[model samples]
Target: MKAVYINELGGTDVLTHGDRPEPEISPGEVLLRVHASALNHLDLNLRASNCRRFPHILGCDLAGEVVQISPDAGTDLKVGDRVLVDNRVKCGGINLCEHCASGNDQWCARQQRIGVDRDGGHADYVVAPAINAYTIPDAMPFTEAAALPIAAHTAWHCLITQAQLQPWDDVLVQAAGSGVGSMGIQIAKMMGCRVITTAGSDWKLDEAKKLGADAVINYRETASISQAVREMTDGKGVDVVFDCVGADVWEENMLCLKPQGRLVITGVTSGSRSSIDLSILQGRPLHLIGSGGRSRRSMADVMKMVNQGALHGIVGRTFPMAGVAEAHQAMHDRDFFGKLVIEH
Candidate 1:
């Protein structure tokens, strides 16, 4: 099997493309011939982190055709089925993991992530629990399906599940150019919300508008994002703030929200540490949320919407399998507007 893997933790220089041993499926698992894989910020961090096992493959979101399945897989999925993977793998036994028994498998203490904890789909083939594979719509392309699992699922979980976003709400989505951010704009619009999104570049802001953002802000040019947001909302502030960038925009996000607005954070691309004015909380009373573990059920909900054509994956660019290193470099530079995919 051909794969892009790393033997050491450092820069993109560590990524190597070559043949590796093909993974075999275990009981309750399936073998997939990966058609496409999507890149995430996590891939960059994993490449630079020290704790990763040597010869690790990096890709968390993937779409593929099922090639083989264990008889004990207990799934409706069959060979040749086109599917997108949910990367979170939880301990299965109800008696062994209380979280799985309670249907909060996202928090299972024994959970293992595909790319982070084990070899992932940056190869010709990968093995995953059958339960993590969901069939994608027949009309969708593999590259597009590969882009959806992580970004769309995270956005859906943050907005619909954690924040309890309502259709009438005025929403603010930070980092309009990002995978999750772009998806956030679409999901907000699908719910009939008035969306105001921000990005460092003007072109990215334009793309956000095409995704149904009612207004867009160039954060690099804007002297005061909070004031701009207030002006856009008639000085009332937004009813919800969906933020992926951290510390850098924390204070402004607080100011841009209505008195009781919800602020759901799913990532901290910017440095995480920041001091907050405790008095702001005392006076405004906001619902501050952290997107923790995402549930399998939320991934199912996202796929249901995709199957209905209510949402679609945003593919900013596609790289050949051998271009994984170049893709990593592009992702590090934040040069793409949506998900960067590697087609096999």
Candidate 2:
């Protein structure tokens, strides 16, 4: 099979597109003829080989059809059934691993990402555990289905599980132009919360508003959105703040939260350290929640929402697989809003 794989890691040049032997399917695993695959910022980090194995194919979000199933080990998956690949891989059983015994597969003591720690879907075919492949509704497009496993699931983990977001709550979402932030705004609104978002320009803010953000800030202009949030809430800040931009916005996020409110973080896109006056937390009694992808049930629930048209896929552009370098540079330079994909 022809696929993109990295033999050594350093820069984009390391992401070489070439042929490799087809992967051997294991017990309870099925072969997937991937129709579409999407890229995320994680691809860049994995490409550098900073955290995962070498000679790895870097991609995870995918939609495809089952071509072959392991008859001896699996139950009922068959050839030609349309499916969406779930990226969260688990290890261990029973008391062997605390994470798995608790049913949090994504946090298993030794888990592998579909495209990070293992071979991914940036190819004509890939193998996934039958349990990780989901049947996508015929009405849903493969492209959109491939986009949901990460950002959408991350948003679900944040607003629903982590922050325990409630209806009619006023919530602030940082990095509104980001793929997760784009979906984050929509998820908050779906829960009936009034949404406020902050980004670098009105252009990104416009997209944020269309995604149901009640208010959008051109962060480059205002210099301080905490005041805006306070004013909007009658001198009280919002109930929850969803932030992934990390240190660059920590202080503002601190000021933007209402007393006893929560802030859920999933990543540190900007430089990791920034000064914060500890007094803000002392005064307001804030709570911070850090989250990542969720369990299979949670991922499936969010994807079902997308399959039903409740949440729309916000793809900024689709670049060919050969344009891997450009895509990586664009993500690093912050050149696009929403999900930037590398299509096979």
Candidate 3:
């Protein structure tokens, strides 16, 4: 099998595209012929830092056809089934731990992500636990299916599960050009919330508005995003603020929320270190939530939306599997909006 892997994590130069042994399936596992894989910031982060193992393949969002499955895999899927991987590996793929049994696999003590802790889908072939594979709609393209798992699921978890966004609520999404940000905007709007989003460029802002953002802010041109949010809402601020950009927008996020409002955070693309003002927090009594991977149930719900055409996949660019290095460069440059996919 041909794969894009790294001998040691550092930069794009470390990414090696070459032949590797095909993965062998274990009990409750399935070997897939990867057709498409989407790139996420997680891939870039893992590539820039040292990994637990060398020759690591970095990608989580995968859509592929099942070529082999363990006899005791306990799934209804068969050899020719087309599926999308959930990316959140749990209990070392055992799926019998307390967290797994309770539908909170993301909290499992032995939780290991597909791309971060193990070899992932940036290859012609990959293996994943059967439980993490879900059959895709027959009409869906592999590239679109590959773009949904991480970004859409994360947005679903943050907006619906964590924040419990209401129809009347006004929401603010940071970095509208990002995968999660773009998905968040669409989800919030679908739920009947008025969405306010931020992007660095005017064209990106216009794109965000097309995705249903009621108001758009160009952070590069604006001095203070929080003030802009207040002005947009007529001094009331937003009921919820979804922030993936970290320390760089931390303070502004706090100020953009209405009193007693909720703020859900998923990623720290910008540096994570930031100081908080205890006085402001206590005065407003805000809710600050840290969200991680979504539950399988949540992923299923979001996928249902995709299948019904209520939610759409936003793919900004596509690169061949061998061009994984160039994909990383595009992500770092922030040259595209929505998700970037690697076709195998």
Candidate 4:
């Protein structure tokens, strides 16, 4: 099997695309012939840090065909079935953990991440617990399905689950050019909410409009994000602010929200360190949420939306598996509006 992996933590120079032994599935697992995988910031972060395993495969979102299943897997899946992996392990099975039993599996202490803790997609083949693999619609392209697991799931978790967005709310989505940011706009719009989004470039803002953003702001050119958002909302501010960029826009996020408005953050693409004025929280009584563990249940909810055609994956660009290094560079450059996929 050919894969993009790292033997040491460093820059893209350490990303090696070559042949590796095909992974063998254990009990309760299934082997997949990977068709496509999508890149995430987590891939870059793991590529630069120590890994639990060497030659670590670096893709978090995968869509593929089932080739083999362990006899004890006890799954309805069969060979040739198309599926997308959930990436989170130890969330289900007969012996449910305390968290899983209570439907709070996101907090399962023994949970492991595929691209981070174990080998992941980004290769011609990968293996995952059958429970983590969900069948995708036959009409969905592999590249599009590959773009959904992390980006769409995270966005769904932040906006729908965490923020509890309402149809009548005016929403603010920060960094509209990002994968989660773009998905957030769609989710908000699907619920009949008015979406206001921001990006650093005009072209990206234009794309955001296509995704149902009611208003777009070029944050790079804007003198004040809060002031612009207020103007769009008749000086009332948005009822919810969904942010992926952190610290640099933290203060602005607070200012863009209405009193008792909710703000949910899932990423820190910029620097993460920042101090909040306690007085502001007291004065406004706002909801400041930090995106914590994501669960299989939420991932399943996202897939429901995808299957119903209410939501779709946003693929900004696609690269052949061999070009994994170039994909990493593009992610670092932040040149794409949505996911950067690697086709096997």
Which has the higher TM-score value, candidate number 2 or candidate number 3?
Answer: 3
Instruction: Quote model 3's TM-score.
Output: 0.96
Candidate 3 residue-wise lDDT, 184-241, digit = tens: 9999999999999999999999999999999999999999999999999999899999
The runs of at least 3 residues in candidate 1 whose Cα sits more than 4 Å from the true structure, single-residue gaps closed, are: 93-95
Angstrom error at residue 30, model 4: 0.8
For candidate 3, give the lDDT.
Answer: 0.89
How many collisions between residues are there in candidate 1? 0
lDDT digits (tens) for residues 41-131 of candidate 1? 9999888884368789888999999999999988999899999999999886345587778889778889899988989889999999999
Q: Residue 291's C-alpha lDDT in candidate 2? A: 88
Better of 3 and 4 by lDDT: 4
Counted clashes in each candidate structure? 0, 0, 0, 0
Q: Candidate 2 on 196-236: residue-level lDDT in tens?
A: 89888788888888888898788888857899888878898
Using lDDT, rank the candidates from best to worst: 1, 4, 3, 2
Which candidate should be chosen as best, given lDDT against the real structure?
1
RMSD of each: 1.0, 1.9, 1.6, 1.1
Cα RMSD for predicted model 1: 1.0
